[model samples]
Target chain A: MTKKERPDNRKLDEIRPMKMKAGVIKRADGSAQVEFGLTKVVAAVYGPRQIHPRHQEDATKSVLRCRYNMLPFSVSDRKRQGYDRRSTELAKVITEALEPALFLEEFPKTAIDVDMEIVQADAGTRAAAINAASLAIADAGIPMRDLVTSVAAGRANKELLLDMTKEEEDAEDAVDVPMAMMPRTGKITLLQMDGIVTPQDTEKIICLAEVGCKKIYEAQKKALLEKYGS
Target chain B: MDKEKTIESKTLSAEPAKIVVPGDILKESMDILPGTGTFRENKNIISKVLGIARTDGRVISVTPLSGVYIPQRRDYIIGEISGINFSNWSVDISGPYEANLPISEVNGYIERDADLSRYYAVGDIIFAKVNDISKTKYITLSMKDPKARKLTGGFITELTPSKVPRLIGKAGSMITLIKERTNSFISVGQNGRVWIKGEDDNVALQAIEMIEKYSHTQGLTDKISDMLDKALGKPKEKE
Candidate 1:
């Protein structure tokens, strides 16, 4: 198939435009807004503060809580209010992805709450949210081994696309993979796949996702330096 | 270069302080020790957050520009009573860690297991100092010092604890200016809470905001002084 046959009419390795800004929310200890093409997500980091439900507090490490939500108007069809099974699972994955990068032991008995709200979703919202959340956590001054950045890669028109968009995601026989990493250490933190693809394609997609995450990493660093004034 | 020469050249000298992000390599030397806001890995001291790198002798640490206040030794802080235990009272120090004020560290000795509620109840604010912090980050408070006591009848506001130094200024100049100009008794906690009392409470609060906004800028003391004069409607004296 020709390049014109690809969804979004772009090259196989071309990613969507990404923009990130840190310290956007006044009330939050740290906050950031991120945009990957048409997908928009805002993440706020609250606390290392008191953990409620008093029983849940951990004396050895800070409990990191992450909430991922999509605004009702975010999708083509309005998303329902409250969380569904998908969002609940996504939240757990995001929290797990961020936990490894933090020095949780330094903040024992505290909870760092990360709230990521997707105000618009085209596709790859989770990846965008991960980038935004990493920025927020850093902005909040929580110690971390490194920032976790992510991107979605998938097969479309028999080619692996760097950052999958809505149209490419809905294509027939698509194999979507969302991958996150601590860019500096090159450590994989989160990886999820949907649909079946050949071993070669899977390897190729993961490699593409790494390259994509590096780009997002630069954007995250740029945003942070801008807010903190270099 | 020999190891000693390299160490001698780097020791007691630091690059001008600049903001750094997570994973940024601060220094690569076994001779230099890593301090707060940094972690050591394979002779490389890497920053763990976005903050300013502060070097003292052979030790390099990072001070966060913004974030929760982590209690350190001998830091004067203000806390609110959250709960009372058998021998200790839990105080919220506005950070992730909760501080415990043991009865022994209170102003005077109180009988153990006696009705402690009468002494200090929940929601009562107190001024104290961090006595000890456990490995698990359990904070302990003490009020045996003369300045440490139960604070009352004042309003509290907060700033980013990192900016507290700016508010206090060099040798307490900024705070002294605020107190004298506003005629308000001000107590600043290292945890970022500020208590102000007097008829000029509004003026103090405004001056504080100005300090916070211009903390990083140069000539802030003069700027705050002009602001206070204008707010107080004082005419400029003819030079």
Candidate 2:
């Protein structure tokens, strides 16, 4: 089957222009605004303090809670507020990705909450949220093992694009691979690859994700330093 | 001070150093490793090196070779109440879920029989401690703690919650600038509420307005710092 062509004839491993701003929220302990092309996300961090209900306490580590949401107007189609099943799943994935990178043991009996809102969703909203969340934590001054940089690599037609846009993602015969990693340690925090791929293809996608993540990491550091100098 | 001097010297270096590999120490004293670059194979796996650290030795720290978020404790945050329960308020802490602030943790002391509604109505802005959390996802808050309470008597300016860190700057520099300029006691809450108490309400209001206007722009810290300095008739220091 002939595959639909993508705009901007570029290499499969290329990413869109990325921009990040840290400490975008004046009141948040930590906050960041990140844009991967037109996909924009705002993330904020709060806590490392008490857990409510006096029940969810862990004697050895802090509970990492994350909320991932898309605003009503973020997409071309308006989304409703509150917990949608997709957001719930995204939240869990985000929390899992962040858990390994955070020094949760440092704040025992406490919880660190991360909230991410998609202001604009062009594509790769989940990955963008992961990137934004990491910056927000740093801006909030939360102790972490490392930053969790995430990127989505997908097979469009036979080509693996480093970061996929909504159009590219929705195209037929597309396989999505969203992965997050501790950029410093080169460890995988969250890895989700849907669709069919040979082991070779999977390895190639992971490598593509790593490249995208590194570019993202540079933007993140630049944003952080702009807000919190060296 | 020495570290700062070294960084300045490196920035001014005439020779553009060749790309350094991961684990290569950039400086002897700091032992900081240069960041890694990216590589791709078979149009599939594209890998990039993030950074390296000496975990086995005395120097034990992890720095990002790539980019990602890191959360620290005792970092002040500003948030908003997204959901409310009978005994707790769920706040959007800026990730995926809400953080809870319980009635027991309300900032001010309430008589045992007094209605919590009277003090902390839903949407009312307040600051409290992130006291604890449970395995079942219960977040505990404490307003009675000295550091937690309702922010009052100041002008509140709102911004996208993500922009809060820039407003605070590194090491409270931005906030300190606002405080010095307006001569106001300013308390920033994680909930997007700012409390500014100035000798003159006008001055506090002006400062808050300025912050709101330029919160998202570049060079805001420097701009606000300069504006504040001028407003206070303080001479700007040569950086």
Best by lDDT: 1
Name the runs in model 2 displaced over 4 angstroms: A1-5, A228-230, B1-239
Candidate 2 versus the native: TM-score?
Answer: 0.55
TM-score of chain B of 1: 0.80
Kindly report the docking quality category of candidate 1: medium
What TM-score does each model's chain B reach against the true chain B?
Answer: 0.80, 0.51
Residues forming the 10-long window of minimal summed lDDT in candidate 2 chain A:
A1-10
Whole-model lDDT values for every prediction: 0.85, 0.64
Lowest lDDT 10-residue stretch of candidate 1 chain A: A1-10
Q: What are the per-model numbers of colliding residue pairs? A: 0, 77
Best by DockQ: 1
Q: What does candidate 2's lDDT look like per residue over B17-94, in tens digits?
A: 222222222334334332212222222211122222223222222222222212223334445566666666776544
Query: In candidate 1, what are the lDDT values of residues A169-223, reduced to their tens digit?
Result: 8778888999999987799999999989989889988998898888888888899
DockQ of each: 0.77, 0.06
RMSD of 1: 5.1
Please state the Cα-based DockQ of model 1 relative to the true two-chain complex.
0.77
